[model samples]
Target: MAGKETKKGRKTGLDEAAIRGLAEEAVFARGRAYRDEGAVSDVVRRGDTVTARVEGSETYRVTVRIDAGEVDDYACTCPYEWGGACKHVVATLLTLIEAPEEAQERPSLAVVIGSLDRDALARLLLRRAEIDPGLAGWIEAECAAAPGSDADPAPVAAQARAVLAGRYAERDYWDDYRPAGDPAELRDLVDKAVPRLEAGDGRGALGILEAVAEVFVEDWIETSGGYDDETLYPLFQDLGRMMAEAALMSDLDEDERASLADTMTDWDAALAEYGVEDSFALAVRALEIGWDPPALQAILNGEGGKDSGTWPPKGEADWTEGELTAVRLRVLDAAGRHDAYLHLARAAQAHAAAALMLVRLGRIEEAVAYARKAFGHPDDALALARALAEAGRAEESLAVAEAGLSFEPNESVSLRGAHSVVPLARWLREAATESGRADLALTAARAAFAGSLARADFEAARAVAGKTWTSVRRDLLKTLRAAERAPERTEILLDEGLVDEAVKDVGGAPGYAVPEAVLLRLMEAAQSSHSDWVIRVARSRADAIMDAGAAGDYAQAAEWLRRAALAHESAGLIDEWSATIEALIERHRRKYKLRPLLEALRF
Candidate 1:
């Protein structure tokens, strides 16, 4: 499980065990798959940290901070909140572990900036700022308060407020990136204020953060259908942390410190003032900054006063007591009050937390009970199944896992949810094999493969089938062949290196309207072993496309004819190539618009 060594003799800071420890088995497998599929790129190493970009639904930048051969911290731009390392982080770690040479040594940005002269650095800043107005504002604000200049936080605060307010007008419901004028600008302002707080300007920095927070509260709480909450909640959390940091500065007066503490702890008044039901971020911040326990508990228990009627009053289904109990459990967990956390978790039916806590406390039987009670959730069932199998209860484990697989509607399971199935499938395979039930294993393998294939995952299918593949290969093929989508069957055939079978399967279908890419794959597969068959199939496909008489169809027909000619020539049948080209031109001769396209095809 040791990581591979690079040419420089440095270990990759990761290994199989470390990766497995960082994520669930399913997530680790996905990360490994991503690495194998070449989704990780631009990996760079600097000391103990590795940075890379992983391509998923969108390209996400991932960074892993390693310390003493363990993952200290890891983050990805992808929004996964499952309390574990995301697939992208896992993929980046795998890339570093498996191919250490792929990650080049990179200089830290601070080091690179320090190496530059003031003028050169300024030029660099200006160039970067030209493309980003937010960066430009930051530079201007910082420069305005440079060494000899009178420092003022007011102008910086005003500029940040303007940037934040501009978001209201630039709002677009359709754009995901700039959904609210780039919330990163607000974060940048917060970052810039940090140095000021460290330089004994606690009050000034606090002013700037307060202004930003006010704008966020106004947009989020005062508006009808507010701006994006996802963007705003993180900013509020940042503000809370900054406020706490600023409050620690020695320059702040006792009165100022008390006022900040009040702000942090007074969730009830804030909720009333804003006329909102909850501000989870504020509640978290209160716990983080060590607010008064009694007041914080009151807020969590919903002893907070009624709404201020700034907006309409809450309806019957606004925010339930169960939801409040869940939040309180989180607060208790954060406060390290394990007894309170477990008590509330059970009361709230927060079975996941209860199971985890029981497992942590070495009460395995209780943990298993909770997990079974929550078997309708895939994660809980997975936990129970893994625990049972590890304790040599294979039969019960497989039964629990099979039940968990039915939790979600088959047609509606998302790709993320599908990952939860991987571990269950693995457990079933292992259980079946251990009990000398090869037939049972084969059945599970085939079912898993069919499910994966339905989700367009040939890799998962193959992994599920493993050594049982040869025994079930023919059956799997027959199942695919009987599927309604011809393309799906053809794809599985092509993937298995059944080139002749794939070509014959698709080619024999007379009017199926096979995808052009599939048709091209068919021709490519047949060209070597069945060149004559390639010519015939390509010519027939071209004829069908040309018969449609659309300009697009004509172009497609000409391309297929070109491939047919190449197939003929490759077989040393020069006359066949020429004859096929001639016949195509004659067949489409009356479609004058296609003449120019046909003439361009060379034999």
Candidate 2:
């Protein structure tokens, strides 16, 4: 846990809420079980990172990066899907929260490396290579001589292929960081090009990127169960992007650029064969046009143009390549080239960025005007609105927000994810309400409720409804009871003490279909008054697991069986509970591991 007071409002490194947020109900249960059983060991915290080995089916190496006392990123060498955080990560986090003393303090990797002299480092590297044979090829590639222009790229390509291939037997492709992107073996190799780019060795960077991209795409095999889309596939896209930036910084002649363009085209075709579409299109365009078209330059110089490819650029990606423009803008911004940053951002149609820059430049009118014209999405609008509100232009902020909403923009990205959280509308509602514009607030609140269907939004809408609450609540409840709204509605109903409605809705549905928490809460709440229903639901769930002879699921089955037993006792059917357990024990008699669990649930 990040046990420090910070400006970001984290009270500790981790809490139950934080850890539980990292996983699903069932996953947290398993992780808690693992933690209670001491499955996580050798826990170490280094800087903002925590690393531990979790004894799951196999020992999984887990690394969690904490920032501002929250999980910024995490990875585990386990083939877990569905749940965002795997069981190993959950177990490790549980260990951090509940058993902080188990984690040993360690020097950060940088500090450790800094303390090592060249001779020690060499010895350490040799030792590592001795332990992992795959590292030898990697070390060779890292120590390879940097070839200048006109040098062959084959050596790099061959070494990359050999290193990746040699690493496969040991790789096992266990890490499925998924949304965070997997740590491919090529990552270290890919990183070598970054410093070259930073040093303005564009051609050299290109050589490294091209060779590595070739080898990575063609030779690097993903052995994990998840799709490549969730792993190294995105890195391949990043290669295209990095190469584009490198090409931009390179001073290549027209022929060289054209040749590079063809090479990119060939790479794109190769990627297309692998189910990737237009992977190198941006890089090829970067080489072909070089971002210096006369029309684009006119706009960059703050000059008007009749054919500047849609002036004001809709503040979005133009035919010239938005992603490439973003790369250049980032470089300029990093170099303190403020004017150049604005030019590139505007020219590249990065409307949101351009507007934010205008706002920071004290040009509120321009920012509001520009943002309204090309509000990329709800987030863009929300950003400008907040800036405007912060700038004391509340009315302007409200106006811009309304205009942005007119585009039917998707929800603003938040912890609930982009699809579920209607942040823009929610913000507008709060802003409008604070400004005493109840009507506007009500409108925004309604929009938020419609999008989110969340209990908070529903309550917000009700609090603001005034005289119309009766009708509004009824309508909202009706909508929330729709087929697709089962999960959210069940939660709301349970919270509102509408147990009968919740029972009928949840009871008619399959036990597996309802949210586990909702299902369990229903069982807990109905244990006395609706004990028969609880018995049916819990027994059905436990029977499903036991009937399949699923050894790993016996614990979960035992949980349901206990719930069933409690319900049976509540309903004065304790004998029935014992009879059910005996029947299950006899029916699943061949499942030696599950019988003991069934016997334990006899009470």
Best by TM-score: 2
**Compared to the true structure, candidate 2 yields what TM-score?**
0.76
Each prediction's whole-model lDDT (CA): 0.63, 0.74
TM-score of 1: 0.46
Q: What digit string (tens of lDDT, one per residue) describes model 1 on residues 1-603?
A: 687897678876568777867775446666776889999999988777788989998889888888887889887877676768988998888888788889888777878889999999989988888898768666666664443345566656666666666655443335432333455666776676666654656556666666555555554444424444565656665675565444433355546555655664554356446444344333333334342345334443444344421111223212323333444454455456786556545534456667767666667677777666654566566776776667666776676766766565222111112244544555565567677766655555655655554434444445556676675676777777776664466666776888877777766553246555556776777787878777777777677868777653565567677777778878998886676667767877888878887877755
Expressed as tens digits, the lDDT of each residue in 1-603 for candidate 2 is 345432332234677778878788768778887888889999988888889999987888999999987899898977687858988899888787676777777779999999999999999999898888657765556655243334245656766676555444443345432322245555666777787777677788888888888777666534322235445677778888888888888889999999889988887776676677776787888888785676666665667655564432444444435466677765565456677667667655566778878888899988887886766577778888988899899999999887666555443211111332278889998999999999898888887887788889999998888998888888788778874754577777887788888787776444676777678887888788888888788878877776776676788888887888888888888788778788888888888887787788766
Q: What TM-score would each prediction reach against the true structure?
A: 0.46, 0.76
Which candidate has the top score in lDDT? 2
In candidate 2, which residue ranges exceed 4 Å CA deviation?
1-18, 67-69, 107-163, 170-185, 188-204, 221-229, 292-350, 372-377, 386-399, 410-421, 427-446, 455-479, 482-486
